[model samples]
Target: MSNLYERSLNVIPPVAARATKLGVVKGEGSYLITEDGKKVLDFASGVAVCNIGHNNKAVVEAATKQIQQLIHGGHNVVYYETYVKLAEKLVELTGGDTMVYFSNSGAEANEGAIKLAKYVSKRQGIISFKGSFHGRTLGTTSITASNSAYRKNYEGLLPSVYFAEYANCFRCPYKQKKESCSMECVEQFDDIFKRIIDPYSVAAIIMEPIQGEGGYIVPPKEFMKAIREICDKYGIYLIFDEVQTGFGRTGKMFAHENFDVKPDIMTCAKAIASGFPLSAVIGKKEIMKNWPAGAHGGTFGGNPVSCAASLATIEQLENGAIENGVESGAYLKKRLFELKEKYPIIGDVRGIGLMLAMEFVGENNVPNGRAVKNIINYSVEHGLILLNCGTYKNVLRFIAPTTVSKSEIDEALGIIEEAIVKEC
Candidate 1:
């Protein structure tokens, strides 16, 4: 029989291309058992979805138990224990002032979030950052500006959508340095509201707390506060797309917590259900209550098994995964900074908790996509899996499981160092 990758060539389209041709038969903790029986250390963690590690015992048991009890009860038609209980838990975790609407994926949850904003505010305009990745749906594609490829040939998208520059201080769109920064990122809204669409016409301003696909860019706390103020001033809803930054990935329950800025609405997924398909639109009760029946609905929004898995995932996060992530993240980050000092190719190291990244650069600080590609190929060939991000694909992001140990991180770093020494 042909291998999985060869077999897939005849059946799967190129649109579903993968980072590696290696197929895995099983996963345990931080390693994947490949089809050829090789153990690969998984540092990408399924793009931050397997937070508690692949096939976590608690998540597996919870999902299996729920499957034995119930499989599919249309969320729009009926109530289920796991679904309702998970919502309640989220509400409690988010301070009891928020309500949740379930969806199957991050894109679906984001679509619901914007719909809720528009419905409640009765506005048609939306504002998103230039380097933000909301989702792939046409509705979300309208608001996403991370890459032109995502929007290629799909023009005439949802109208009344505007773009703004995200607070990427490292690259500073305004060309301002950290020492003498003038906060142009915040002030740009003034120009936007005056020169572009009226603030009153905007239903929502959506952004990722940390730009994932664009680059692991973390903005300053003041920037987040200013955005909240802008939304409040214009009576527009503020939405944080936490799909890749939530559920302990940032060592906090949510990335927004670190900034101490509360958004009017938030969307979460990725690691919400361990490895299950699940997402949520979490909004303030006052705003969510205004979104009436028929405003938004999904057939498989809140799968019982997925919700059970989410609850178990949350349980694991609270039971020490997040704390462990904090410790490991600090260690990894420090080591990365050391690597940056040793290798001039490492232009910068940034991110909070385990969501860290290293941007490779050539002379004069030009993005070095080729170097990143070479390093990743070498690392994977040597038994480690990694992923690249940024519009230029020069940013190597570290999405290690929050349950990762110091030894695992050290092992991964050793592999990374060897790749860098050999390729860079």
Candidate 2:
């Protein structure tokens, strides 16, 4: 076969140039079997989507049984037991008698949260942080300032979206040292809230408990607490984007649980459905009460099949995997710290639970995304898959499925070591 496919789709993007990327035949647990029968360790886990790991028995059975019964009758009018049950489970897991509105992806969930915030508070301005990635939808895109590529050519987007500095210990955007900083960025809030816009004009303060696309940036404890206080002071809702950190990815049911600071509105997706397209806004009862019944919904927002998968996924996490995330996350973190001592290219290592990142920096701690790219490519060539993201794209994000075994962890680490030292 001499590659007969023509470049016929310019409407999508000319940048999507590659064809015949690695093909996978099947996935079981932490390994994906390639079309050529090669076993590749799935460290990325479809960008942290497959938290229970690939081919979970219950998830497969639930999807299969739902398919046999009913795939999709449309979620708008018709009622489905699975959908209701999953929502109930969400309410239970999230606690506080919270309500949920379903969507199809992380972006949609965030988008819905934005609408809900404004609807309830009747406010317009939305505040986000630099290096934060909410989603790719127009509304979510406006808040995402991590990369120009996501915003370029798509300007004049959703307006009134403000940007603050995401917590970066090494590169503190607030002009403070990591150890001595007094959560000074919160001061920026006073200026913005008073002069830039009235407190009543603000809708919500959207942030990640752990900044997901922001190099897995983890703010100090008091920082998030102050954010909560700011939201409270202004009567603005705090939206925790738990798309990547929810469902045991952060070694807790929700990342905010660790800080004792709760969000008024929280969005969850990705792992909620064990790879199915299901997401939701879990928020305060009063705040979410403004929805006028059919205010927000999707054709497949709570598709019965995906809901079943969500139920099963939640069950898995609640049962024991949250604990597993803690144990394994500690083990993995310790190992990465060791790697940092050996590989000077690893300028920083940070993250919680199965979510982690290794920043490649120059001697002066300048970001080196090129080196990170080289390591990712080499790791893939050596039978492992990894991802890179950050303000500089100079970080290797290691979000292995929590179901991964100790041996698999060691194997992937070995491949990463070789890629770091030998690939250069």
- Model 1 alpha-carbon drift over 4 Å, by segment: none
Compute each candidate's TM-score over C-alphas. Answer: 0.99, 0.95
Per-residue lDDT of 1-424 in model 2, one digit per residue for the tens?
A: 1112332343546665532256677998898887678899988888888998998998999888998998887878787889888877778877756898888899999999999998888789999999899999888999998888889999989989998876677778876897787767777888877778877889999999888777888888888998898888879999999999998888888889889998999999999888888998999888777778777777778888899898888888878877887888889999999999987888888988888888899878888988988888888888898888787889889888877778889999999898889634
lDDT of 2 at 343: 76
Residue lDDT tens for model 1, 1-424: 2299898999999989699988899999999999999999999999899999999999999999999999998999899999999999999989999999999999999999999998999999999999899899999999998899999999999999999999998788999997799999999999999999899999999999999999999999999999999999999999999999999999999999999998899999999998799999999999999998987897999999999999999999999999999999999999999999999999999999999999999888898999899989988998999999998999999999998999998999998999888756
In terms of lDDT, the poorest run of 10 residues in model 2 is 1-10
The lDDT of each candidate is: 0.94, 0.85
What C-alpha lDDT, on a 0 to 100 scale, does residue 282 get in candidate 1?
Answer: 97
Residue pairs in collision within model 1: none
TM-score of the candidate numbered 1?
Answer: 0.99
Best by TM-score: 1
User: In angstroms, how far off is 335's CA in candidate 2?
Assistant: 0.6
The regions of model 2 sitting more than 4 angstroms off are: 1-20
